[model samples]
Target: MTQQNPLPQEDQQVTLISVRDGNISVTSARALVVKAHKIALKIDTALSEPPAWTDEQSLTMIYTHGERVMRLRGVLREQVDTDRITVEPVGEVKEGDRRDYRRADVDARVYARSAGTQSPTEARAAQVALQLAPTSNAFIPQVVNISGSGLGFTAHEVFSAGELIDLRLVLDQPAAALVNVIGQVVRAVRGEGDALNSYAVRFAELSEADQDIIVYTVFSNHFAAEGLSDALDDFDE
Candidate 1:
């Protein structure tokens, strides 16, 4: 998020959600934060793909910090090349309690496979996927953010919406915790390139135990980030 008076801080990430004619699209091929005030949000298309978003497109920018989620409306101000976008906050920022399914931005890589949709997320399935991750059959993608119900990642492969996927996520926030689950692609977005780097998967038949594991990891990562920011402030002081 741009370090404007109300915006979060420099280098923070924000999700830009756009809806047009009854279709809701999570424009993730390219979109991130830099800084500013009164700036209309300029969401970018995938750097590899030619720009597709039009100027003056309205959007909702979502920024989550700790237990709070800040939502601000904005419009396309200016496209900063193909890799960056700037949004001018439109109205009063609405702050709300983060839902129980709060998400945390993360960086991790896990094993992925798409045969069809919807399968049981059992312990056995997770174990098999973990073993396969080091092998060639698995398409390893970089996991970006995660919540109890789903996760977001970017990869070279394309998985269409409603497609069921089997995932083997090994998270380090809980020290090499393994999450084996079947999820349906809620959103699959491509960058300018051939890669489908922006994908959101919603868990199907995720066990309560598995869900707890994700929630634990989410909180672990969230607090760790906050702790680091606090340390930085103290050092500066």
Candidate 2:
């Protein structure tokens, strides 16, 4: 009975998942295989920040081989700097199903405030007023994940489900976009940061044009992550 080998070849692309900014920001870091061992792996990654392991002291890789995609989960063995990590494979390697990415995991800035039963029209008017004359009451939240219809952010402001809120979203990727929209709190859960809660809000009756802007914002990063080599090349410089 000889030792098992996980990967036999090299130069394969893998999505190295990691969290940073005190776990307030989670990103899908793309990494290429630098070396493969009998039971461990070393990868070269492009992470925005140093690896901050989540609740589990492990590293997960979404590896695409042939036409089937697979996930390799293992505990962290080393930090090698240069965004590299050695993972000791824990379980057997197997192919996993490919998913249609609905939400983009991001770390953009968003400002939110509780609306307290205001209609969408009223909330929109209030958002515009604050933009012209910004107020201290505005809270900047770290966006965890976002889609066109809803978004989740971690902030100190506690909001109960079903309450209305106004948001000023500043998108600076692909294109610059400053959008104001009304949303209803759908969920709130415990998260990182000093006195923070993760709030999920669904856009409430957004106009067709406004909805389009958000949809583009959500996918812009997705495309940039898959291709757009120039976008990332300049990032390192």
Candidate 3:
């Protein structure tokens, strides 16, 4: 299939998805190489453990490069080795435009409170009220990664898709502060066995100042780790 977006960069972080019997399994992986209509992935070693895959099963690969997020559908082509798998694209690569603010992989602690208790009409109005009020029923979830636009985290509770939630994130670097925002759940993939379910949520009605903090923290942390000042300038441009 034809893709309007540029090809994925090598070594970019990717999430592989395989669905069977109505259950979707997602694994963290990386793109080894990107070719026309195909890509090779360094599969996660855990794939051998349980819920084995078959050649007939199709896969969805999601990855972010720069400000674009691409979700490509493909079928397993070959198992290159115990750790590598090749896949051939089955349809046009789906691309989504992200905010100028870049995403940084982080393991920071996040507390979230579901607004599911409120009616749908009320929830829409509540999200616009600005500050997120702390609640005794708040859940401390592990934030997988974050960007100005959205964040992904893992939680034991299965938060239904389209649910609205309030978040309070504590940042440790580039000046520590608490960030409060309302977000909508975009996707929730349950992990294998008893593992926590992973959720991807998109921020909604965030103030410009709050977004600046998220962007600065992400860029600061990322540049500090990579030690690449040039890339920082490029990101600003």
Among all candidates shown, the one with the greatest TM-score = 3
- The Cα RMSD in angstroms, rounded to one decimal, for candidate 1 relative to the true structure is 16.6
lDDT of 3 at 172: 53
Q: All candidates' TM-scores?
A: 0.47, 0.47, 0.48
- Candidate 1 — which residues are off by over 4 angstroms? 1-98, 117-143, 194-196, 227-237
lDDT string for model 2 (113-202, tens) is 787655877777776676532233453635457775678887767788888887766655544455677888899887665667888888
Among the numbered candidates, top lDDT falls to 3
lDDT of each: 0.57, 0.54, 0.63
Give candidate 3's TM-score: 0.48
Per-residue lDDT value at 122 in model 3: 59
* Weakest lDDT window of 10 consecutive positions for candidate 1: 228-237
- lDDT computed for candidate 3: 0.63
Q: Report the Cα RMSD per candidate.
A: 16.6, 15.1, 16.5
State, as a TM-score between 0 and 1, how close model 1 is to the true structure. Answer: 0.47
RMSD of 2: 15.1
Residue 195 in candidate 3, Cα distance off native in Å: 1.3
* lDDT for position 218 in model 2: 50
